[model samples]
Target: MSQSFSLRTKSFLAGLVLPLLLGACESSVSVRGNFPDPEEVSSLEKGVHTRRDVADRLGSPSTLSTFQDQVWYYIGEKVEKTAFYDPVVLDRTVLIVKFSSDGMLEESHAYALEDGRVIDPVTRETPTEGQDLTIIQQLLGNLGKFNPGGNK
Candidate 1:
């Protein structure tokens, strides 16, 4: 009788713990952006391929240069996330395709995750030419400013 109870308890504990362990090990993978195939990217030739041909092959770029339309960026990333944990980037690819003024491919470069750099943004606030008022002061300041009459 004692041995049977011990075995039953062990099985119950395993049934509860096994699923938790599996759940913790499970991670969801998310792929975002148009990650072009290696064959498609290799098909593009510098100075030979035009923007229309490249666009037709690889589709529209993820984003164009902020100031100009000459540079195109095809950015892609794969992220894995587990329950209650920050997402981890498994892979990142940035394909930069530069075009000349005449719309021909000038140069192309592919950057992987290892070639990327992390930039910390500046947090300093810019001084503005205005007086900062508190909520209470703002409410009290407007109390007497209201003109009840229809006249301005």
Candidate 2:
């Protein structure tokens, strides 16, 4: 009888603990964009390496300059999330490569996660002209105003 009781207690404890362990272990990681190696980037020479050479060494850029085609940007970021919380940025890197009009590498710059500044997003809500109605008010608001389809 004691053996059976011990087995039942163990099984009950296992069933309760298993789900909590699994729920607490939930997490996700996301990586975006290609990050170039420092050694490879150093190999590129200003006013010497062409666009093709840069592309071959660093891979295609994540984006080109918004206002000009002479600049290229390589962006990389890693984000992580646990359970139901918002994702947090774990790492971020931005490499800017500028080319001369003749397509030679002019300059390169790298920005790390610590080099960035945080900007709070705009959260002000725009107010519109309307009466805030409750569920019952909304449901009954148009009940008597509906005109049955006779063209009047």
Candidate 3:
């Protein structure tokens, strides 16, 4: 009876432990945006492919140029994350397709992850020219400043 009980206990612990181990080892992959195929992009001929033809082959672009409607951009990113870590970018691709005023393709450009630049965000707060008042001062300062007529 004890032998059977011990074997059952081992089996139960193994079931729980195995799943936890597998779960811990699992990684997640996340893909965002439209990544155009190299072969299809290469097939396009500048000055030959029209807007309609490009759309049919590559689908809608991820975004259009901010100031001009002549350029279309396709941006793609792939990120991977382990069980508890922040996601890491595995791949990034940016494809830019420009069209002439007549709607024919003018130029095509591809940018890989290595071609990108990283800029650190500014964190320091700019000090404004003003008096720093305490809570009591702020409350007292507003006591006589109310204009019931809504004018200065």
* Candidate order (lDDT): 3, 1, 2
Global local distance difference test of model 3:
0.94
Q: Give the TM-score of candidate 3.
A: 0.78
Clashes of 1: 0
Model 2 residue 22 distance off true place after TM-score fit, in angstroms: 5.6
* Residues 22-128, model 1: lDDT tens digits: 98879999999979888999989989999998999989999999998899999999999998889999999999999999999999999999998999999999999
Comparison by TM-score, 1 against 2, better one: 2
**Residue 105 local lDDT, model 2:** 93
Root-mean-square deviation (CA) per prediction:
4.1, 3.2, 4.2
Per-residue lDDT of 107-152 in model 3, one digit per residue for the tens? Answer: 9999999999999999999999989999999999999788878965
Better of 1 and 3 by lDDT: 3
Model 3 poorest ten-residue lDDT run: 143-152
Cα lDDT of all candidates, in order? Answer: 0.94, 0.93, 0.94
107, model 3: CA deviation in Å?
0.3
Leading candidate by TM-score:
3
> What lDDT score goes with residue 123 in model 2?
100
By summed lDDT, the worst window of 10 consecutive residues in model 2 runs over 143-152
